[model samples]
Structures are given as structure tokens and as C-alpha cells.
Target: MAGLVDALGPILELMTWVGFVPGVPLLVWGLIIARRRCVWTRTTGEVYSAGGFTGFRWTDQDNVQRQTLVDADVARGLVAGNEVELHYDLCHPARWALGRPKHDNTVLILGWILTSVGILCTVGGFVLLLF
Candidate 1:
């Protein structure tokens, strides 16, 4: 029984580490997506559609000219010289672009999942060390 417990301890520790490894990136990305600001603006140029994507230029806050692109679904109804709001990560202004519509529940879901996994792994690792 002692040998069995010892063997199981290492396996559980590995599993816990594997499970928690993704939590950091997931949490960071989730926060980045969550805190992004969306601003409404009118397209200043023609929207070109190609290869299932669309692109156009627009003015953002600070009156600076910027370009944006969106996938098929959001692009379908957009037209040249049309008004649209862009969701962009403030921390990565150069990557200004469109993103999916905000889902209130997604943040909570990701936060909980990542936190749980990270905690579980850290706890499991400690438990293994003790065993």
C-alpha cells in the first residue's frame, strides 16, 4: 500500500502540473479580451472582402487613422463608409482590430476554470511532495 501510494503521488503530481500549465496563458488572454475597449467609428475607406475576410480603414480615439478587419459574419453586413465599433486591446494598440461580440458569461467561465486548474495543480503538487 505504501508503494502504491508513492507511485500514485508522482502520477497525480504530473497530472496536476499538466492541468495547471495552461491556466496562466488562458487567464492572461481572457483578461486581455475582457478589458478591451470598443469604440464606434465610421469607415473612411472602401471595405474590401477577400478570402472570407474584410478590411477597411477608420479613425479611432485621439483622431488617429487606423485600419481594421473582421471575419465573414461581421463583415457581411458592413459596407464602405459605414459606422462600426471596434473592439481593441488597449495594451496592444498596434493590433487594433475587430473581435467577437462581448459575452458577459465568458469572462466568469474562463476565470473560474483557469483559477480552479491552477489551484488544483499547485495543491496537488504540494500533496505529492508530502507523500
Candidate 2:
């Protein structure tokens, strides 16, 4: 058991790099995008269902019609021509989402967890090296 543990020490230390390298960047990018999404334009749209898929359609400020598929949760209880709320980027009308845009914490949480693990591993590695 001790021999196996000793053999894996260096490998575990190197694996920490895998988490640190991507975690910080993911957290930063998630924050930036979440912040930007907070300012998207809000409007009322209509839901539509076709063939086994559900989506919504709305007109942009330019009066151009736009449509995109929605997730099951968003499509629940909705039917064709049902009115729904939507959020969209003013600069890119095609970029839209159901409901008001808010900070999606999924990426942020994952990034934080990975980064914390990496930091702990690094600190422990250094402590072990010194002692």
C-alpha cells in the first residue's frame, strides 16, 4: 500500500494542473458572459410546437421574425401560439433565451469546485515536498 501510494504522488500532483488550467478560465468566462446576459432585451413571444419539438417565435426590434427550440421545462404547459416571455441580445436578435436572463451558476459552481480542488492539491503537494 505504501509503495503504491509513493508511486502515485507525482502523478496526482500533475493531475492537479488539469483542473487549475481550465477551472480559472471557465470561472472568468462564465462571469463575463453572465454579466453581459443580464442586459439582454426582454419581450413577449409566442410558443409553437411542431413535430415533437417545441420552440418559440418573436419579432425583434427590426420586426424580423425569429424562432428557436426550447428546453422541456420551458416548453411545459405551452402550446402553439401560446404567449411567452423571452430575452434576447439586441445586437444579435437570433441569440435569445426563454424568460429573463440571469446569471447561470452551473458553470461558475463547477469552476469553483475544480479550482478549489486544484489549490488544495497544490498546497498539499508543496507541504509534502518540504517535509
Candidate 3:
């Protein structure tokens, strides 16, 4: 029992830290912030790297070329020399991610999944308490 609960530690911690009812909304809010705040610019970039770490290069607002390597999570599986859209902050272009966030947005998917599991645990915790 302790092992199982421990495996769910992160989810439990999210609820405990943010409160169960607000946890999912907080996640949703974060997603909304990402979508709204990130500057979506159409440009071509080269995706290179493998075995988990990947990177890409694109020009910023200042026309300064930029590349994200060893730190970009969405850089994998993208082919090289192919034109790709990139999403990044104008003030912080180095932190850019893949464009077309509607497709294969790993961060969003993981966030939703984590939020769901946290909600489930919150409900279970309440039930356990009531019993």
C-alpha cells in the first residue's frame, strides 16, 4: 500500500500543494498561459540530435540565429533540413519549442494526464477519509 501510494507521490503532492479542487484548473490555467503567452512564429529550423536529447536552430526577432540543444524536450523525432514552425517567446527565443502545438504537444498531454491522475487520487483520498 505504501509502495503504491509512493509511486503516486507526485500526483498526491500536486493536490496537497495546490489543493484538490483547484489543482486541475491550475494545470489548465498553465496550459492556457503557455498557449496565450508563447509567440508563434513561422520559420524553418533544423532538428538534430537523438537518444532523447534533441535541438534546433532558428532566427530570432533580432535576426540572431538560435539553437536549443540538450534542453528542448520537443526537439526529438523532427527531421533535419525540413521547414518547421517554431513557438517561442520574443524576449526569450532560445527557449523555443516545436510549432503546431495542436499535434503531438507532449507537454500538454503529460500535463492533462498528470492532472487527471491527481484528481483521481484526490477523490480516492476523500473517500478514504470519509470511510
In angstroms, give how far residue 31 of model 3 lies from its true place.
Answer: 17
Q: Which tens-of-lDDT digit does each residue in 51-102 have in candidate 3?
A: 6666777777778988877454454556655567777767567665564534
| lDDT tens digits, residue span 40-124, model 2 | 7888998888898999888888888898888888677888887888889887777787656665678888888878878887877
Ranking by TM-score: 2, 1, 3
Misplaced by over 4 Å in model 3 are 1-39, 50-53, 70-76, 100-131
Tens-place lDDT digits, model 1, residues 2-121: 787678777767766655666556667777876674443322345666565677665555667766666667677887566555554444444544554345646546656866866876
Clashing pairs in 1: none
Considering summed lDDT, which 10 consecutive residues are worst modelled in model 1?
Answer: 37-46
Candidate whose TM-score is highest: 2
The residue-level lDDT of candidate 1 at 79 comes to 70
As a whole number from 0 to 100, the lDDT of residue 101 in candidate 2 is 64
lDDT leaderboard ranking: 2, 3, 1
The TM-score values for the models, in the order shown, are 0.40, 0.46, 0.38
* RMSD in Å for model 3: 11.5
